[model samples]
Target chain A: DQQVKQNSPSLSVQEGRISILNCDYTNSMFDYFLWYKKYPAEGPTFLISISSIKDKNEDGRFTVFLNKSAKHLSLHIVPSQPGDSAVYFCAASGTNAGNMLTFGGGTRLMVKP
Target chain B: GAGVSQSPSNKVTEKGKDVELRCDPISGHTALYWYRQSLGQGLEFLIYFQGNSAPDKSGLPSDRFSAERTGGSVSTLTIQRTQQEDSAVYLCASSLDVGTAVYEQYFGPGTRLTVT
Candidate 1:
């Protein structure tokens, strides 16, 4: 069972525009959520994260918004650049879970310059 | 300040053969995890090791799949009698520790295994 799901398999946006990636989870026990960016033939790199208690967290041009009631969270990249094109994965872990993360299928973002 | 590293970046093995993949976690990091990613699929948890505690092999697909962490530093994942379906990229990650605090996991480039 996939606890975390990224419904959109791919997204395309113009450079300098806003890019929004969405993720949903079924398990309410998950307390921490994170986003990772992955390029071809490379490992995923950490992007940003948010706690269950917080609704939003921002880092530089990336922002993550969480809605506990909806079991939904989103990653927003402002002024999206061509370099932002990659697969973004949403992962979650609960307390005492030993940091074992459940990752989503990932959304492929393409920024056209 | 090296990140996680995996050996044999690419492996091509025939069916019924056995393959062992290795992972070297970051120095001083006590948590290690193994995951498999198939084409067009998300990462699948395989196993986890934390300090000297018992390893969590709950996510292992079958008895043919196993992992071992030696000295709490390097880890090895073995897949015996590999099948064509066993083809995938095996990824290794390490984190400082596990607790209430959210620990970011650093991943290696991964070992791409192809079972022919």
Candidate 2:
């Protein structure tokens, strides 16, 4: 079963606009969440993360918001740039999981110039 | 400083043959993990190792799959009796778990294995 799910397979946004990618989880044990950006032939690189203790975390142009009650999270990129275009994966882990991450299918984000 | 490194970026083997993939984690990292991504699928956890502790092999699909981490630095994943269904991009990641509550894992360029 897919504990983590990215319902949208892809997203497109014009440059300088905001891009939002959503993810949902079914496992209550998942307390930590992370987002990774990947390009073709490259490994997924860590972008941002949020803990169940906090509702949000931000890094530069990227912000991750988590809603524990709903078991959902979203990554927001403001003033999106073409360089942001890539596949974004949402992953979750909990103390019970012991450092292993459960990843979503990934959402391809296209930032138009 | 070098990040995680993996060998044989691409490997093609015939069916029924065995293949071994290697991963060299970043220096001083105490946590290592193996994951694979099949076609049109998400990353699937395979195994995990942490500082001389028992390895987590629950994710291994079958007894034909196994991994070993020597000296707590390099890890090798061996797949026996390869099948076309075993084709996927195998990825390795590592993190520093010493005295840290939250660890961020750094990944290596995956090794794409094709079984024909």
User: Model 2, A1-113: lDDT tens per residue?
Assistant: 79999999999999999999999999998888999999999999999999999999999999999998899999999989999999999999887666799999999999999
| TM-score (all chains, Cα) for each model | 0.98, 0.98
lDDT tens digits by residue: candidate 1, A35-110: 9999999989999999999999999999999999999999999999999999999999977554799999999999
lDDT tens digits, residues B4-102, model 1?
999999999999999999999999999999999999999999998988999989999999999999999999999999999999999999998855676
Regions of model 2 farther than 4 Å from truth? none
Segments in model 1 whose C-alpha atoms lie over 4 Å from true places:
A96-98
Q: Per-residue lDDT tens digits of candidate 2, residues B8-82?
A: 999999999999999999999999999999988889999999999999999999999999999999999999999
Measured with C-alpha atoms, the lDDT of residue A89 in candidate 1 is 98
TM-score, chain A, candidate 1:
0.97
